[model samples]
Target: MKTKAVRMYGTDDLRLEEFELPQIKEDEILVKIMSDSICMSTYKLVKQGKKHKRAPQNMDTNPVIVGHECSGLIVEVGNKWKDHFRPGQKFSLQPALNYMGKLDSPGYSYEFCGGACTYCIMPNEVMELGCLLDYTGESFFEASLGEPMSCIIGGFHANYHTNKRNYDHAMGTKTDGNILIMGGCGPMGLGAVSYGLQFENKPKRIVVTDISDERIARAKEVISEETALERGIQLLYVNTAKMKDPISELMAITGGHGYDDVFVYVPVKEVAEMGDKLLAFDGCMNFFAGPSDSQFQAEINLYNCHYTSTHIMGTTGGNTDDLVEANQLSAKGAIEAAVMVTHIGGIDSIAEATKNLPSIPGGKKLTYTQFDMPLTAIGDFEELGKTDPLFQKLSESCKAHKGLWNGEAEKILFHHFGINPKEL
Candidate 1:
């Protein structure tokens, strides 16, 4: 089969090319990618090229497709797993397959098994590791979002609090405790906030901090304080840029008791240090951001670590269990995955979008693999609608959902673009 994909040749080298895909082996399955959410990890991979642990060398000759957080329909099932998976079934996968302790993974090391293409082959290791998941969600975008959400859930699960009695360590965040999300208004941060609010052991209070007023405002509008109140959780969004003393002001919100769990969403040294100061007694600070710099350093309070049990940890990709939990939570409507999406485009836009993802101001940049369109933000639809009727209809659909992307807008996009989902 021939597939069109954005392949990475080297550092800052990406090409939109059409190539023939090798026939799938009996242990491999073919998937027609429907939607893929661009991630910053892809940008890092592009910048590092072969230096990235998951990325392969010799990319000039053997390039790998970009994009990992993706969802689609099963086009052809290999005979080896025909009983477990069938054609036309919705699917998503945990990209961080630590199979046999190998660092290789789809979207980084695979030539034909990445999410950026119209169709890609799933190797046997994916199914063997049980990373291939059956998605029951109504929309493919939500399924695409499940991967990132799984990362957020994994961070929450990685947090640990210590018990003084037996010197035991407790897994997961402290239940019904004060939680602080530092730099929590961006795409992944918003997902963290939404998941924290809807999690089974929901925190009693959530304090979100961001330097950008615009992001804080948009986040509040999406997951309003009223909605959080209905769930019996106290939610607060603070623009640290406006505060005279951010530490004092944030501490006041927790009644000077400090936070039980603090998540640092930014990789900046200052943000990490700020999170360190905000931790309560036995507080667990999770550095959730992935920094591009290998020399990135942040100073922590070792005094508190030795005296008060304050600790810090960091996690990267989520495991299979976290991905399954993310799928279940999203399917049940407990978490609004749409909150992370702000822009949508087609497979043609992947190279540019993934290359400049950090500069783009918004949440997730969703791409429809079969379509050919420029990257457009949901908020810009109303303005772009003046000259284009397609944007006009999409603007109406998004406005109906409070300036957010939805499945209805997705269908409208496909229909207007003359790409039929049924045919894919």
Candidate 2:
């Protein structure tokens, strides 16, 4: 079968090309991709290409597809796996497969499998590890968002605090405690906030800090302050760039007690250091951002680590369990995955969209594999509606959902784009 994908040949080298897909073996599966959400880590991979650890070493000889966060329909299931999986089932993937202690993952190591492609083949290992999960979500975008949401959930699980005796330590964020999310208006940060608020061990207060007021405003709109209030949670948004002393302002918000849990979303040394300084007694700081450079370092106070039990830690992609939790929460409406999306486009625009992801001033950029359209920000739907009737319908759908992308908007877009679910 013929398929199209955005392949990465080298650093800053991405191409949209057509190729033939090999027939699926008895142990393999074929999927037709629907929705894919762009991640910052993917941007880093685009810039690093062959130098990336998970990236194939001989990209000049064998280029690889570029995307990890995606969802699709099972077009053809292997005969050997007929009992476990079937055609027409919707599914999402957990791409962090630590197979044989090797860093082989989809979108980085796999040539035939990646989220950016119209169709991809799932190898035996992916099925053996249970990395592919059946999704019952309302929209493909929700399933695509499961991967990024799992990363945030993993960060929360990695956090822990030790007692004075050091005999016992509590794992995970403190319940009913002060929590601060640095750079909390970005795509990943917004997911962290939604998880933090809706998590079973809910916090007493959540303080979200960002440099852009526009982003902060969008965060509030997505995860409504009224919802937080109804849940007895105090939600505060602040632009640290406008503050004389950002740390002091954050400290004052906690009434000088500092934050019990600090999540640093920016990978810069300065932001990590700032997160460390804001830690309260027995506070745990989770460096949620992944840096591109290996030698990246952040300074921390040793005295605080020893005397106050304030420590910092970091985690990479999540495991299979985290992926399942993310999928379940999103499917149940316990968490809103749509809030992370701020832009939408089609597969044809992925090449240019990825090259300029850092410059794009919004949250996650979603791409539809079957559609051929220019990249459009969600905020500009109304403006674009002036000329296009489809965009006009999309704008009305999104506005009805309070400016956030949801399943309703997805259905509208799919119908207008001529994607018949029954046919798929």
Candidate 3:
């Protein structure tokens, strides 16, 4: 069956083109993708164009589907598929598979699963192994983010207790004390902070770092759900641009003993090592962001590991459990999906957004598959008539006298005051 997908011809040359999507077999189900967000890791992949290197610079022999985080309701199920799933029910996929569990999984070598795509024709062997599940009132976007979340949950469950690479012991009621989060401006980084801030037995402080001063300023003001400030939830917002020695400052803030857990949300090797320095004795450091290139590696002081018992671990391409926990966490208020998504656009804008994501100011820009126009306002704020503050700020930044992401030059003036989408 033919379906529309944002096919990538090469770097920054994505197209909204129609292609034949594979049909579901008796054990497979069909889902029309409703919403998908471009995660930062996927953003780097799209910009690199490593999917099919042999393909021409601006052309493709095969169409590439363009998202990994997505949500949709089931529309069709064959007889065999019907027993485990039903039509019209909300569902999100746990996209990767542990090949040892699945004979139908796409590869025989190292780990292999399709990258981010609008929709997937996943194999039944992966599903029956119990990675994907039905959504239970969690926000569809939250459900889409499950895979990433699962890794965080799985990280905690890992034999880190027995992991002797770094810290041999951990001290906390629940979490690894004080977490330093790099790249707090983006969705994945913020999600890690949210987990650190809200999860039971969490750290004493969450120091969020990003190069963009504007994004960090906003995060300091609006990035939490809890009431008490002393719940190990200190927001150490810093200006990385001004720092000649950021690691020293990070260490000073944590009392030189360092954080119990430092989550390196970006792929920069230096940042990962800095997190290692911020560790207390026998501390654990997590590499949450997958580097765009395979050659990316961080150099940690092995002596620290030998004497202090510091542990270094990295994770990528989330598992099935990530989605389930992410969904439940969102429902339980650990995550606020509405606030996390700052921009909404359609297919064409998604093409542009996919190209410009790393450089953009907002956290995440999502596209609704059913919509035609890009950048439609999802909230009830009436379009500003004469002038609006946000619009005014945006206009000065855009300097075109039209709305942000305008293709047809439709000048949409946003409101200075209005109802929020989350309030409803």
Q: For candidate 1, lDDT tens digit of each residue in 29-58?
A: 999998999999999999998899988778
Provide TM-scores for the models: 0.98, 0.97, 0.76
> Whose TM-score is greatest here?
1
In the range 1-424, model 3's lDDT, one tens digit per residue, is: 6566676655666777665666678876666565566666556646666453322333355445666566666767767877788877777766555556432222111111122333445456656767547887534556655655665555544414324566454432225466677776666666566566666665667777888887776565456424326564666777776788887887888788687666677778777777777777767777777776778877788998888877777666556666677788776766544435566565557677777777776666665554453553323122431355544444453334112222111123212223121220
> Which order, best to worst by lDDT?
1, 2, 3
User: On residues 1-424, what C-alpha lDDT tens digit does candidate 2 reach at each position?
Assistant: 9889999899999999999999999999999999888888778988987888889888867888889999989989888888999889999999998999988888888889999988999998899999999999878999999999999998888888777665787878898999999988999988988898888778899999899978888888889778898988999989989999988988999999999999989888988899999999999998888877889998999999988888888888888899999999999999888888989999999999998999988889999888787889989999989999988988999999879888888888788888975445
The lDDT per prediction is 0.91, 0.89, 0.58
Listed per model in order, the count of residue pairs whose N, CA or C atoms clash below 3 Å is 0, 0, 16
Q: Candidate 3, after superposition: displacement of residue 163 in Å?
A: 9.1
Comparing 2 with 3 on lDDT, the higher-scoring candidate is: 2
Which predicted model would earn the best lDDT? 1
How much does candidate 3 score in TM-score?
Answer: 0.76
Candidate 2 colliding pairs? none
